[model samples]
Target: MNPFRYERALDVDHAVQAASQGGRFIAGGTNLLDLMKENVERPRRLVDISRLNLDRIEPLSDGGLRIGALARNADLAGHPQVLRQYPLLSSALMAGASPQLRNMATTGGNLMQRTRCYYFYDTATPCNKRSPGSGCGAVGGCTRIHAILGASEHCIAVHPSDMCVAMAALGATINVAGPQGRRTIPFEEFHRLPGDAPQYDNTLGEGELITGVDLPAEGFAGHYSYLKIRDRLSYAFALVSVAAALRLEDDGRIAEARVALGGVAHKPWRLPDAERMLAGETPGSRVFARFADALLEGATGQGDNEFKIELACRAIVRALEQAANGTPQSQVDKRIA
Candidate 1:
């Protein structure tokens, strides 16, 4: 790791002041530390906010949730309110890294995580996200895990976060504090697509600190699923993951729906077309197939990951089916050989 100065923040104001001078904010240090060790991220200073009083899970008056950014993944996943109300989020969190990692990973850090692209992590390789204006090595190189949607010629990397996928589907709001002041950002607008400027991941401003996320009151608890398909499953990054939520009327007709895809784009790819198609349709294989087709309408994969288009289609259908049947994974779903 590169030599860097560190300071423990006394509070949110202190954190903002300390980080306003181009220092990186360190909470759980799970992702940032790894990047620093790999020399992918070399911050001159780290403002430690883990000691700040930003670690609480409170219920909002409007039946929503106010999750502190410093809340650990394990605690957030296992929280009674989360498991009972936001099962989709719980499942997604549990499907992510191991227990030890979950214990150390913070919600804010997870939201600020970088892509798991091999080229981005390899200093020898040219990656636009890593080094601006550098040629993208994954464009024509090994792209089995690259994106299939919202990918620009400059970069084709995908965001790797199960929690963000569910949060995107839930329409959460991210609260941020900065040198200027505090503001809230819609979940959908938080992360940006990898356009020409692949170097920037999200829409966060300079010297901004993520304080927490606000989940709306209306949740898809009764019918929601977070299905992650991977190579070996346990602790592996997602090959294709689906976060599905459906609110079916008493007559078995869908009243509302939300679907988001991970491991396929720069951010959690929301399927608005598929969601519209599912609005009035009944839950069935035929309907699910149509939903999946709508999701893949504009998807074009690279050579090695061309198979992901079809795989994502099948995964979407399966995830929706499970969600409709109210059988989202409570634990990690693995196929034992």
Candidate 2:
């Protein structure tokens, strides 16, 4: 890793001030440290926010929850309020890395996590995200883990966070503070497509630091499923993951539905129109399959990832079925059903 100055922040204001001088904000240092070692992120300074008072997970008067940016993934998954009101988030967190990494990965860090592709991490190859103006190697290189949706000619990288996918499905809001002031960003608008600038992952402004996340009152806790399909049963990134939530009417018809896809796009792939198509419709394979097709529209893969199109469609159907049946995939058991 490169030599860099390290400063421990005393509070939120201190952290933002420290980062205003081109210093990068780091909490938990789980992914940042690895990237530094690989020479992917070489910052002149690192402002540590681990000791800041931003680790609490509290309930809101409106029945929602406000999660601190520094809250560890493990703590957030196990919090009583989270398990009771937002089990989909808990399931996604559990489906992520091992317990040791979870203890060190914070909520804000996960939100700020960068997109990953074979060439982005391999310094020897050309990667537009890693080095702007350098050709995108992922366009023809190993694309098994690359994006299929919202991919531009400049890059085809995919975000690697199970937690973000679930949060997108639940309609979580991001809270941030910067030199300008504090602001809230809707989850759908936080992460953006590659477009022409593949280097910038999200719309977070310069010197802004995420403070917390707001989960709306309706979490669809009773009918939710987080399904991850990876090469291995544990400790591997997903090939295609699905977070499905539903509200069943008293007549057994679908009142509402939400489906967010991971390992398939630059952000948690969600389409409000596809979700609206399921409203007031009957829950069945036909309905869910059509919804999947609508969500996957315009999704053209690079090469090896073409299989992901069908895989994502089937996974979406299976996830929705599990949600409707009230049988969420067990994170501990590692079984499909």
Candidate 3:
């Protein structure tokens, strides 16, 4: 890793102050440190925010929950409130890295985690994300884990955050503090699609520190599912993942439906029209399959990853069926139930 100055932030203000002056914030250091060591990230300075007083998991007045940025993945997954109110998120977190990693990964770090594309991590290859203006090697070279939807000619790397997929389906709001002031960003608007600029991941401006995330009261806790399909069962990044949440009426008709896709694009993918198609309709294989078709309408896959298009469509249908039947996929089972 390149030499860099280190600073331990005393508080939020201190962290923002240190970062606004061209310092990168480090909390949990799960994803950031790895990139640093790989020479992919060579920040001039690192401001440690791990010790900041921002690790609270509290209830909101609107029957929602607020998750602190510093809250560890393991702690958040097993938290009583989270398990009770947002089990979809808990399941998603559990489906991510191993127990050791969950113990160290933090809320903000998970949001800021980079893609796991082989070319992006390999400095020898051309990766637009790592070195802008350089050609995208994943476009034609080994695209097994690249994006299938919302991909541009510039880059096809996919975001690899299970937690984000769940959060997107649950309509979570991200709260951030910056040099100017504090603000809240809608979950869908936080992460951007890689059009021409693949170098940037999210819309987080300079010196903006994610303080916490707020889940709206309507979590669809009664019915939700987080299903991740990976090459390996243990600690493997998803090739296709789906997060589904549905609210059924007393007559077993769907009241509301929310679906978000991960490991398929630069950010968690959600289509409001596809979700709306399920509203006021009875749950069935035909309807869910139609919804999947609508969501993947414009998806085009690169070579070697064309299978992902079919896999994502099927996963979406299965996840929605699980949510509608009140049987979310069990992470321990590892089978498409």
Q: Rank the candidates by lDDT, best first.
A: 3, 2, 1
Measured on C-alpha atoms, candidate 3 has an lDDT of 0.94
Q: Model 2 off-target regions past 4 Å?
A: none
Model 2 lDDT at residue 317:
97
Give one digit per residue, the lDDT tens place, for model 1 in 1-337: 8899988888898888888887889988889999999999999999999997788999999999999999999999999999888888988999999999999999999999899999999999999999999889998899999999999999999999999999999999999999889999999999999999999999998889999999998789999888888887688899899999999899989999999999999999996756888888889988999888888788998999999999999999888898888887555436411
Q: Per-residue alpha-carbon lDDT of model 3 for 1-337, expressed as tens digits?
A: 8999999999999999999999999988989989999999999999999999889999999999999999999999999999998999999999999999999999999999899999999999998899999989998789989899999999999999999999999999999999889999999999989899999999999999999999988878889999999999989999999999999999999999999999999999999878999999999989999999999988898989999999998999899999999999999888887
Clashing pairs in 3: none
Q: At residue 62, what lDDT does model 2 achieve?
A: 93
Q: What is the lDDT of residue 90 in candidate 1?
A: 89
lDDT of each residue in 1-337, candidate 2, tens digit only: 8899999998889889989988899888888998999999899999999999999999899989999999999999999989998999999999999999999999999998887687888999988888998989988778988888999999999999999999999999999999999999999999988888989989988889999999999989889999999999999898999999999999988888999999998889999988999999988999999999999999998888999999999999999999999999999999898
Residue 174 of model 2, lDDT score: 98
Which is superior by TM-score, 1 or 2?
Answer: 2
Candidate 1 Cα errors over 4 Å, as ranges:
333-337
Q: What is the Cα-based lDDT of residue 317 in candidate 1?
A: 87
Worst 10 residues of 3 by lDDT: 216-225
